[model samples]
Structure formats: structure tokens, C-alpha cells
Target: MNKQQTPITFWGIGAQKAGTSWLYYNLSKTPGFSIPPVKEFHYFDRDTKYPSPNILSITKTRDRVFSITYLIKAVRAILSSVFRGNFHNIGFFLKWYFSNYNDNWYLSIFNRYSGSKGEITPSYSMLSKDDISKMYNLSPDAKLIFMLRNPVDRAWSHFRHIKKRIKGFKLEDVQEKEIIEFIQSEGQELRSNYLRTIENFTSVFPKEQILVGFYDAIIDSPEQLLEEVVQFITIDEQSNKEFNQKSDEEDLPTKEIVNKSIELDCPPEILNLLKEKYHDMILELANQYGGYFNKWYLETYGKNSVNENNRLQNTIHLN
Candidate 1:
């Protein structure tokens, strides 16, 4: 196999605060696996007029008005190249696009840090339909890996993390009540209508080409889960000990801490509303992945499972 023909890419389309960073770390450590240095290369989020290296500085502009033309052009170009004319044209276009940008710089980071197969940004999950279609046009054979978590918890975690970055921002600066209200109001719509993201991803890629792992599963069995991932990507397990080393300790908010943070930010009424809106989704996720979380916690800390359960109960008050 040609070195450049590797098809593995991690598409972390984040329910932010879903232990994506932890997964990235573990995946990178796996022998013969190559993960990019910049974990979230928000490439497919928007288009801007900046040069290659400054791609990071280009803010993600979510305006539909500006994107319509690009979207149309991308769709038309993809359809035309896929069915109408020479297939070589598609390869030419991909090379041209990558050559114009600092993909070399991006790829260099991967080469320096990676092994055999390469993983790109998690931000690929947030890609617009047009952007994803373009990705399909560029590399239809690329393998996709997605990690999902409880959306409500994910949103809450995202809010708390973002609060720290805004200057002069008290958590109060952005009304926690209002934030929860917005999330609750939008919960069903957001959860059910992922047509533009996850649904689209599944549509274009075959089931065999994609791996949908839950964050809960990854947290529970890092070694086994990672070994499965390594096998899936066809990387050798015996060549590396990095996967067995202790993972870097970067503390993330527990369910208790997240809820406390939420309580600190808003009133009881808003909190209740947020809970009500998120309740069904949370229950669904718990029913699906809670077992994994329980097993993972039990294995990782043994008797501390009680403490973890207490913390989770205190947060969601799930019986």
C-alpha cells in the first residue's frame, strides 16, 4: 500500500465536552496511528480569504447568505465530477485545493506526531452538508470515527468551558438561565434534526466505513476499545508501548461539578426547565450507554463507583 493512501481520519463532530481530547490522546498514542497536532482543525466550518498558515485565525462564519454560492458550486462540481466527466478531474481538484492551502503544514504536524494512518480534526463532524459532500468528493474511501455523549451534559460542559475564555466574563455575564432555556427550547430540534451532520455522514459513507463509538465506552475500556480501534485501522498492536502508558491527567468536569456550575449560574426555575427539556434525551442516552459508563467507572476506580454514582445522581437526580 502506498504510504499516502491511508484512509483513516477521526471525525470528532463534537457534542463538545464529550471527552474528545482524551480519545485523541489515546488514539495518538496507539502504535502506527497518526493523529494531527491541532485536534480540532475547524476546516469544514467556513470559508475565508486568508492564506494557508492563517487558516486557524479565520473565524467560523455561520452566515447562510455567504455560504449559499459555495454550497451550490460544491454540489454541482461534485455531481458533475462523480458522474459526468473524467474521474481524474476529481483528483486534480483535490490536489489543487490542498496545494493552495497550508495542508503541508497540517500534514507535517501529522507526520511529525503520527505513525501509519492519519487522523484529522474532530471539527469535521460540524461540517456543513456542502463541506461534507466536498470531503466525499475528495476522499470517498476515508474512514470516519464519531463519539457521542449526552447532549445536555455536553452543552453544559461547553458553556462552562467557554465562560472561562471570555474576557471580563463572570459566568453571570451570560445568563445561565437564558442559556439553559435556549438549550432546552432547542433540545428536540437539535437532537432529532442532525440531518446536516451525523445523518449526512452516515448517508455518504457505508456502515463498514464508519465507526460510532460512545464516549462512555471509550472511558470504560481504553485499552480494549483502543485495541479494537487499532485493529480496525489495520495498525500493528505489538510495535508500541505508548498505548499502555498512563494517560495525561487533565481533569474534566464530573456530572456533579457540571450541575454545580449550572446551579451557580442560574435559578432553580431555569434549571428545572433545562432538566425537563433534556430529560428524555438524557434518559435515552443513559439507557443506551449508561451501562458502559458504569462498567468503565467500576473498572477504573473499583469502590469509587459509589462516589461516581452519587455525583451523577446529584447532578441528574436519576433514580
Candidate 2:
């Protein structure tokens, strides 16, 4: 195996459901780029039990658990065996066992999985300050890309999506109001506060290393935006064409589903209050982000610019 040089990792650090899956799918298809087999590794959230396929043994040896020097040597051996395709090598098996030691171990896993480039969990957007710093420290040169969307729409879509997953799961401890409140709060936080994620990351890495793309731009002209992404990652021409062609229509909930979700998740009074509270804030955010909300609305609703006469006619019809 060729000695590994610096590897590029894409961190989704997300506005979930904001075209992240689509981005991952298309980028993974790029011939030279090695999108991880599992898109959302989510290693930072919590350590999961190792799969039998990957885990060599459960025997608790002091070497596996205690000694830092022993652990590093064991990891190096395991990595070598795995990469060499020598499954029977005990050292390789042992390295696989200790792969969860640090974020660097995860980066090594990416190197093994793909020859050219690798990306990690998009959920890194929700990481705390310390985690982000640790990620930077582990791979200082790793490029970061953040995908952002209209907060109201993104949040509503996310809520409906998550609610479907836990449809029959009872939550006796948490009331519907609380759930709605949680959703509303999270939505607002993403809109208002998540910009700080950029600030925090930029503090550690230079401006050029970090790229931010709006969801509206991606939807409007994916080819162009994807080309920019390809340039940033230094992907080849053939891979660029493949990545551009892989755009698929993202599945979104219908208006009826969104309304139904709001009804089911919020009390009428609270819903009305939230609508009133968020209307101005949403518009302000829209304006701040270069009318991102308006662009999204027009694209989604297919409304041409309304003239004064049309507005007057609509008012008369309402009366």
C-alpha cells in the first residue's frame, strides 16, 4: 500500500434534511473521491458497540484498555493488517478493536476505506466547541463545508420527518406542547445562533479552508455550485461531471403534511403565538441572507412577482 499522505474529509456539520443526504450521495459517486460506505458515522455522539464483523475479540486485556503505548502499537498493527487484507493477522484484528481510541483513529479508517478522499458525519454541525476543536486538532488541513437552508422550512421539514420515525412510540413524560416548544426552540436556535458555528470554526481555520453554500443556490443551480465544490476539493474533470449529473430531486413533505404536523405538535394558542413571534424574525433572517426565504418561496410555490394591481385584486376578493 502506498504511504498515506494528507486526506481530505468533508464535515457536514449540518442543518439536517437540508440536502445533506443528496450531497453525500452525489459526492460519493465521484470516481476518485471515497465517500464513506456509511454516510453518517456519528462517531463523536457516543461510542457504539463494535460489530462482530469488525471486532476480533471481547477479551479485556490490560493492553486493550489501559496502556497508552500498548494501545498505539496495537492500533498500528491492526490498521496494517486490515489495509493489507490480512484478516487472520492478530495485530490487524487488535487494531480494529481499538479504532475508537480517538478522532485520528476515525481518520485512519477513512484512509483505509478510500484511496483519494473521505468524509465524516454531517451531524458534526451539532458538535460542541471542544469537539470541533478536537476535530481541527486531529486533522488540521481537513476542509469543512456547511450547507444552510431557510430555517423555518428546514425545521418544519425536520420535525415532520422525525415525528414519523417515533409515530407509535409513546412519550408519556413529554407532552405535545413540550415537543413543539423543543422543535420551535431548536429551529430558532439554528437560524439565529448557528452562524456562530462558522465564526468558531473560522477562528481555528483560515477563511479559504471553510466554504459555506446556501441551500437556495444549490437548488437553483446545482451544477454551478457543485463545480465550485469540486474545485474546492480538487476533484478531476470526469469526477466533476459525474458529481454534477447525480443531482436527484429531494423528497419533501407536502404542505398538508406540514400543516398537519404543526397541528398535531402544537396547541392552537401556542401555535398562533409562535407564528406571530416568528414572522418578523423569519423575514429579517430572509433579508439578511440575501432574500433566501423569498427565493425559496418563489421556487417552491412558483409565484411570479406580484404587481400592485394583482395585490389590490386579491384584497378585494378577500373582502
Candidate 3:
């Protein structure tokens, strides 16, 4: 493979079950950008094992069942690049897929586009402080984005997502006790712990370089929120120029929610526990972000006790 220019990288390190997927979808469609065709690289936060490219291992990319059909599409993209006389940077990923993970291997994923490019991987949010420090050392100037959601709601959405996608279970058949256990599950707690994610990243990256957004913005004021993030990412002079990836984006989504979770039953007891479990997180986010999080704490917390249904939970089953 011929030498290529290193791409400028950015991130959407996230609070999963938040609006990260939505951010990824819209960013890919927006012009002047080139993102990996695969949404989640699962690189920085993954165990260094760097599992093989078999369907089971690759399934972690989207946190959904692996489909052989997608593999076919990937091969087709590679072959098309060759026919166009541009090999892209298949070497790093091809090797990374079958071999060990390296920092260079991760950088090469974004090498296809010399213009500003990045991977909007939500799993990166769960990375350890040491791992995040490694991430900071990599692209010191890389603009990082984090979208916060109400921890309680994020937990329920995340639980439903995994239960439906990975476990192949129906929400109707799930028990309240199971929901409670899942809320406290290690994976769920780690991702929902926005406080940890922020502290780790801010300790490394300058505060101005990291943009924190709210998932509520996507629902309430999507365009404005998206515009803010876009400007922050492209503020660097190199990212100012426009690029043409229209052909690549033809098959991708334009305006839609990705990985929309199915509504699941949140028993009153489970809801009570979840609100209790994430109470501190809610108060912290409210103190930090203020707008929606402030509303989340006020609307969800009642003076009586954990059992008392707050205004929002009473109106809608939060779980």
C-alpha cells in the first residue's frame, strides 16, 4: 500500500443509549466529513485481546447480532476502492481485524479521508482512566464530544437494547427482578456513570476541546444542537474545507434514529430502584449541565420516598 496522509481525528465518546448513534448517523450524512463506514470501532475501550474478525467478535461493533451480509458489503467497499485505483487504508484494519491492536492501527482507520474525520464510538465512553490517557496522548488536539442523558432513562434504554439485541429476549417475558439486576450490572453501571467518563476525559483533554451535549437536545432542538457540535469539531482550520464523499454516503441514512430501542415494561418497583440507584448521578449532571438534567431531577424526584411516583414517571413509565 502507498503511504497516505494521516487523517485528523475527533470523537463522540458517549453515554450509550444516549444520542450518540443519532449523532453518528447525522454526521455521516453531513458533507465535508468522512467517517468509518462501521459506526463503532470498539477500539480504545476494548480489551487489548483484539479478537478475530469472526462474526461473533465483530458483532461487538454494533452491539447487535452479526450479519454475514454486512461482511459482504465491507468486502465490496474494499474492492470498489481498488477498482477506483485507491486502496484506502485496508491494511491496518485487515491486520487489526485478524491480529493485535495498535495505536497506529487505530489511526489508519480514519486515514481514508485527509480532511477531518472521526469515529463516533459510544463504547469509548467506558474506557478506563489509563486508557483515556493513552487516547489523549494519541491526538492531543482531537475534539471530543460527549452527550449526556438522564442516567435513569439511559439505563432502562440500554438494558432493553442489550436484552433485545444480544439475548434475543422479548420485553414482555422479562421480569421486574431481572430488570433490577440488569440496572446494577457492571456494563450498565459503567456506561451510565457519566461522572467518571467526564472526569477522566477532562483530566486529559482541555475543557474547550471537549464538547458536552445533552440527549434531550436531540429530541427538543436537534438541528441547533447538531450545528453546535459540527462547528466545534470543524473549528480547526484543516476541517474547514469541504470534501466530497457523497458517493459513499448514498447508501447511508440521512435523518433517522439509529438503534431505536423498543419500549419495555419498567415495573414500579424497578423504576423506584433505578431512580434511587442513579439519584446521585442525576443530581451531579443537573449541577453540571443544568437544563434538561435539572428538569430530570426535579420531575423525577419526590419528597416522600423512593416508592412515590414523581411527575414524569407517573405520566409515563420511565422504564
Candidate 4:
């Protein structure tokens, strides 16, 4: 298909820290798949803010120049796009960051690839209803990929990630109270809410279009999970003229470690707190989406994890 006619194949709306990087890396290396060099385009859910905003994307230009992190990200995106060795994409990147990014401009980023194309932006899970509606208007038929982790496990992992970013970050140096407050915060609450993600997307798209995967599968059957995703895309885009055929049997794919988290085991007390706080959310998740998630609930909250967490809390609280 030509560039203008090419439709977006899929989107990875994610629960952050849930194997998105690994998925992106595998897809980038795999033949026949054409993804943008920059993994998180943040198109559907970016701040879209700059000092001087465009009229069409009204209020997109945020007053973010004052923040160091925003400046770093802005510079990084432009630099990555420039150094990608594709001259045409520079124009696309310029328009993406500076002007109103219409659907065609967004398509220009991936249409360069003859095979299947899409992007992964985990933050899109938290997109507002208006933004998600905008996404629907652009590519209603696009497949969505959402990966979930155990609520407590995912929250703890995300907390640890924040701490780990500091210089010489250590599990021992982190205080228990800090972890508790972090878990209770609105941000973490939103990230771990698989049900909200389900409800949000289903508001605009059908159930079959969304693929809810498990973090458990990533550890247990990485190759199978990757293949399943590839198959999912291929089924939709089979008619694309330039799509490449799957490789031979001997060319088996090898999994690469991408953004592996530090192995700081969750304290039982913290685990108990997480479980207690997110009990309903987790239970609802288990009820709605079974498989390893169900087993995870039984094995985690209902089994030894409960006793272990309570014991740790008893030592700390003495209540």
C-alpha cells in the first residue's frame, strides 16, 4: 500500500514497567515489522505543550521549558529523530513537536516502512476521554496491546524504579513509610488499575480489538508471547503488498533483556499493604481476566504471601 493509504496496524497502550521495552526491542529486530525509531511517540497522549502553541492543537504548547525534565525530553526527541539517518523523518519530527500534527503527519512517521507499522506509548493508558476519542477517530480499526502485572508486584516494581533512579540507590536505604505513601499516591493507583484501562478503551473500541497480555507470560513464555503478537498484527494486515513472510524454523528468535528491574524483593509488610489497598481492584481484575492472573491472585493474596506480609507488618507495627 502507498504511504497515504497505509493504516496504523496496532498500538501498545501500556501499564508502565510491564515489558513494553522488551516488546519494542523484539519487534524492532524482527523482520517485516516497521516501527518508528523512537518507541514512545506520545502522539495520542503527549503534553503537546510548547512555548508557542499551534492553533489546531490548541493549548498543546505547554509552559514546560521551565522544567529540566521537559527540556531534556524535548531535546532528546529532536536529536534522536535527526540522528536516525532518515532525512525525511526530520521534517516529520519538526512538525510533530512544533506544529499541529494531523493524522497524515503521524502516518508519515511509520508509512516509510513497507511492512506492518505501529508505536508503543505506555502513558496512553491514562489518556483522557477526549484524547482517546480523538484516537478512535484516526484509526478505529487499529489493534491495541495492553500488558498487565500483579497489582502489588507492579506497584512495588514501579516504586523501586523511582528510587533506583537516584544515585547509589539501595533497597536498605529506602524507608518503609516512603514506600507506603508512594503506593497510595494517585499516580501509582492509576497505573495499576487494569480495570480502568479496560473500561477506558472499551468506551471507544470493541473488546476483540484489545489484547490484554500478562507479565507472567513474558517471564514464562517470551517467544510464544512475541509470536502471538506478530500473528495478531499479521491477521489484520495480511493484504499489505510489501509485508514480509515469516522466517524459517532455524531462524528461531532469541529473547533480549530490556530494562530488567532490580531484584529488590518486596517486603512482606509492604506487600500486605499493597494487597490490602488494592484488594478490590485486584479481585475485579482476576474476575474479569483469568489465566495466570487468577493463579497470581490465589498464590499471592490467598496463599503464603498473606502470611509472609502480615508477619513482616507485625514486626514493624507491634499493633
Best-to-worst lDDT order: 4, 3, 2, 1
User: For model 1, how does the per-residue alpha-carbon lDDT over 1-319 read when each residue is reduced to its tens digit?
Assistant: 2436434344555444555676577665555566544465655553642111224443433432266764575456556777967465455333323333443433433334345545445455555566677666545666666655544445555556656565566655665555755565433234322224456776666657665555554445545555555455554455334433432343222212121223234446654555565454444344433543443334323422322332221011111
lDDT for residue 244 in candidate 1, whole number 0-100: 38
Q: What tens-digit string does per-residue lDDT give for candidate 2 at 149-255?
A: 65555665555555656656444545767656756564335433445666667767666667666565555655555556655665456655554455444322211
- Model 4, span 178-226: residue lDDT tens: 8888888766777777777878888888777788766767777776677
User: lDDT at 213 for candidate 3?
Assistant: 77
lDDT of 4 at 181: 84
List where candidate 3 sits over 4 angstroms from the true fold: 1-6, 48-100, 166-169, 236-255, 302-319
In model 4, pairs of residues that clash are 48-60, 49-60, 49-61, 49-62, 50-61, 50-62
Model 1 is weakest, by summed lDDT over 10 consecutive residues, at: 310-319
lDDT per residue as tens, model 3, 57-94: 43234443155776675576666667776554465335
Order the candidates by TM-score, highest first: 4, 3, 2, 1
TM-score of 3: 0.75
Task: Pick the lDDT winner.
Answer: 4
lDDT for position 263 in model 4: 72
Candidate 1 collision pairs: 12-122, 13-125, 220-296
Quantify all predictions' global Cα lDDT against the true fold: 0.48, 0.53, 0.67, 0.68
Quick one: RMSD of model 1?
Answer: 12.4
Better model by TM-score, 1 or 4?
Answer: 4
